[model samples]
Target: MLSLQDYSARDALDLAGLVRSGEVTAAEVRQTALVAAASVESRLAAFTEGPFEQLPAHSSGEFAGVPFVIKDLLITAVGVCGHGGSAALADAAPAEADSTLMRRFRAAGLGLLGTTKSSEFGLSVAADQKWRGPTRNPWDPQRSPGGSSGGSAALVAAGVVPVAHANDGAGSIRIPAAHTGLVGLKPSRGRVPLGPWQQELMYGNVVEFAVTRTVRDTAYLLDLVQGNAPGEKYGAPLPAEPYRDEIADRSPRQLRIAVAAHGWDGQALSPDVRNAIELTASTLADLGHVVEEASPAVDWEGFLAALTTTWCAGTAAAVVPLLKSGTDRDLFEATTVTCAEVGQALNPVDLAVAFDQYNALSQSFGSFHAQWDLWVTPTSVGPAPAIGDFDADNPQYTAAEWVRRCVVPYPTCATSNVTGGPAITLPLAQTADGLPLGVQLSADLYREDIVLRTAAQLERALPWAGRRPVVHVTTETRQR
Candidate 1:
């Protein structure tokens, strides 16, 4: 019998090695992953379904024979429904064939386990679900794991899988990574293919990637999945070589690094988060990287207003089909309803204004990047809030206010989304309360190699993959 702890932290390369050395067969890996998934699914609520069989044949790619899970938002293997964490689409059928992304993942040798949970329509930052119940933080079940990639984070943090697919529109990847202590890279927009049905950019901010414990795993996946699919609207230019090479030769030239612990929109950061940022700055300075305090020039209020408008419009776009199908009655949470309504209220003029503001913010960020090679900040304003911290039922504060206060580090992440730059969150520091506190490192557009190279250096300086969540499937539990 395979140990769940050993399986959880084992990188894709290690799993491949296990298969190569005859230490474990691919079927054995599948069974072990299923066992681990079953043992933790009830307590963690990370998965939307139990163990799934009929995985594709192992490919000859680098990570061939490794078991993994995809977030329910993205289409995956046949017969899997991408409920997108909503009751309305609970019975949705699988696509006739694999999505372009899924084909690439399969080609790279990953065994599909099952779909993981995501926030309804990938909206709220909290992973708590109205239908399936909240996906608890493995660090502390009472706290939020962060969403809409919450399930992926929980499973990885809880040691269910080494890595799982995650996407970011409004900091989905980074937020959950911050909450759960993992390495999350939100690649430059258009870095990966989104195919078959959709073409032109959806919302102009969303980008998909995976969250992993090791920096090398992320770099390897990025190298594998990044390129233009046959019918992709556009593709980000490829790096000179694979990103995997960047991790091995990880020394980025001493960079001009800017540190900002507080939110760009003026929200105060918690002391623990602030200290993490300060510590990161000190570490970079010790490494001979120049560090300074800087704020990019932009109309902060206008930028945020534009983002809200665009986000609401996107929400409205998503809600229209459900409403037309008379399925709005089945929507999971009230917050989703409110956001969709806000989206519906906006007219063409509102959308145009938002687009113009986005362009302006992009230019503003470009100017800031011109001054510095990298920007370092805390991934969130505070540590992971308790599960109910962003409760939609709260009458004391409006939903918008709650989102703003809870996601104070959004500006640090939102800029990358709007500008199509690469941003990475590293689990290099921890809070006094023993919660993981992540630091955000971002670079100019298409400089993912730089961002990842820096992450590799930090990973070596302050190793974090060994730090597993307390509530994980151990050998003792597996015996049962």
Candidate 2:
């Protein structure tokens, strides 16, 4: 049997190695995972569904025996209906078939264990759902794990799983990864498919991937799951080589790297976050790369305005159907209702203009990247916020007001989402108190190769393998 300590120390790829080598059977690995998950359930309310009596059966492959979970939004697996941590769809029916991503995930040899929580419709960076309560951070239970992928982040950080599904629209994957000490890659738009169900999410701003404890896991998973689905509306360029091979070079080619030590939107970064950015820039410089301070010229307010317009409009489209079907309005979060109303009232011209702004921003980023190979910045203004810092249920906030208060704080995240570029958050640094603060590396569209290689170099140089959350599987098990 795999002990808790042994399981927690090994990443997904390592576990698969164990299984593949016949050191342990897949069933034993899964049973150990179930025990680990059961031990921490109360401390982190991370799941919307189960460590079921029987998970969907998966086949032998790269991650053959590794347990995994999907965010309870956007992606779906057969026999599991993600309510998306919402009261509005508490009774939603199970998905009849696997979504394309789920199919790919299963085929990669991952055990589809269950679904994890999301903010209602993934509306907030904090996973404090009004009905389901908050998903606690594993590092500090009183603070968030960052969301709407909070649930996934918590489990991965606490060592219940080495990697799990996450998606980013405006940093859903990266924000949580930043806070939770994980590797989150929001791949180039269309690098990971979302299809047979729909073409794009958040008007091509959203992309699906997962949070992992190692760069190898992120790169390997991308290799396993990335490609365009049948009839997909967009397709990111194929990688030059396998992503795993891309990260294998220790002496990666030196390039011009721009560092944004200060927030692009002029929001103040905490001393810890600022220090991390400085140290990361210094480290990159030490590694023979040209690091200089620079930022892309962007119409910040205009971009946010356009984002708010599209976001609210998308919310309205999703929620209005539920309301018309006689689902009580109160069942939806108050902020959700307000956003829906704002979205519903928008003219077609308003939405079109918003998309035009996206195109303009994409061009702006393209020109900026022409001067710089990669841009690095703090993933968040600081570490995870106290659990109550964001109140999604507050009716006082208008939709725009909510965006300003909650979304604007993490200012650097939405840029790559806007440009359809590849961006990654690596847990390169941590605060004095042990909370992880991530440093983001971003490049132009379809350049995840650069992002992954740089991240792999950082992972080797400033390794985070010794860091463990307070509520981790090893810690909790040893105490018991």
Candidate 3:
């Protein structure tokens, strides 16, 4: 039997290749993953569900035997709890059908072990909410693993799984990915399906994708899972070629790269993040691309206010179904209830103005991209906060204060979601103190090829996949 350390050395693709060659059976791989998940569950609180009992039936896929986990947020699988980090829905009925994305994952021969925790309603950027306690960081057990998709990030970082399902609506995937030092891609809007249920989320603010250790996995998964389903209300145009093919080309492309390392609210970036951005810019220049400082000339005040309003309205809408299902409304966090109140207080005209601002930013960003092929920035304003640092249960802070506490770091994140563009985070650098520092690269709408190729270039130019976190599953010192 292979030890968990041996399994940790290989990514999902490598495991699949071993299975294909008959070197190891899928059952053996599943057992290894289950052990790792169990080993880290006490310290990391990674999965929303427990010790994956059995593998789901395999689909005809490129990665037929590899183990995987999805965040408990959006994509649903039959009999899996999709509570989405809310206490009210903790005992909700299991889903009756697999989401389109889940079907694709299974078809690719991947095994779904279970689901991971999510921020309550996918609102806060940290998993330190009232419902599921908090998803601790694998790098430092006392700190966060970034949120909404924090649980998925934690599992992937701790070597429990190579990749896991994560979705970004207001920077959920990329934020957590950055926090945990994984390759997280929030594909172009309409790139993935939101079907068998709803259309676009928050007027196209949310998108589903994954967090992985390498650019190749991100590219391959995109090729496998991206497509417009029959019922999708919106869809992005198909890529000219498969994303895998795009990243593999890696031939020197002379594109203008813009470095937008500045904070959104004019807050100064942490020393580590600042150094990482500078080093990345210089590195990109060394890679023979014209690198310079530039960012989307967005209306800071208006964008912040509008973005917050949009989220508040969406939060309100999400809770109503729970209410109709006879859930006790008082069980939710204070922030959630406050958001719903703010959302309810708004009238139609107010909502329209907010959306119109979103549209204006979208159009403006579309125009801004005409000047440069890509925009790169620090994934967060600073390092990960200690696990109970930002409290969502406190009603004392207003929404703006809440954002200031949690979101000021990842300023550039919501831009892609708002503009229908694509963005990816690479685990390229670390703080002088050894904390991971992620850098983001984003492209215009429907151009995942740009982000992937650039990320692949960065991966080669600055290799980071072998850098393991301190509190990991493979070592004897692994925390309990």
Best by lDDT, which number?
2
TM-scores for candidates 1 onward, in order: 0.95, 0.99, 0.97
What digit string (tens of lDDT, one per residue) describes model 3 on residues 1-480?
557887887888888888888898888889888888878888887777755778667555899888889888879988877887889888878899998988888888889888898888888889776876898998898999988799989998989888899999888999888888899999988898987688877767999989999899899988999999998987989999898887774566788999977787566898888889999999999889999998777887788778878877887788866767778877888788777777767788888888888888888888878999999988898888888777888889786667556566688888888888899998989988788888999999998988998899989989997788877888633443
Clashes of each: 0, 0, 3
Comparing 1 and 3 by TM-score, which wins?
Answer: 3
lDDT of 1 at 155: 84
Error of 3 at 23 (Å): 0.6
User: Which run of 10 residues does model 2 get worst, by summed lDDT?
Assistant: 51-60
Once superposed on the true structure, which residue ranges of model 1 sit more than 4 Å away at CA? 200-202, 249-251, 328-330, 392-406, 409-411, 475-480
Candidates' lDDT values, in order? 0.80, 0.90, 0.85
Candidate 1 lDDT by residue in tens digits, 294-356? 867778777777777777677778877688778855554676666677788889898899889
The predicted structure with the larger lDDT, 1 or 3, is 3
Clashes of 3: 3
Model 2, 1-480: lDDT tens digits are 899899999999999999999999888899889999988988999988997647447587799989999999989888788796799989889999988988999999999777898999989999899888999999999999988899999999999988899999999999999999999999998899988787887788888999999999999999999997788988877788999998995678988999997774787889999999999999999989999999888888889889999899888878998899999999999999999999999999999999888888889899999999999988998899999798889999999999877667787898898898999999988899889999999998899999999999999889999899999988888777
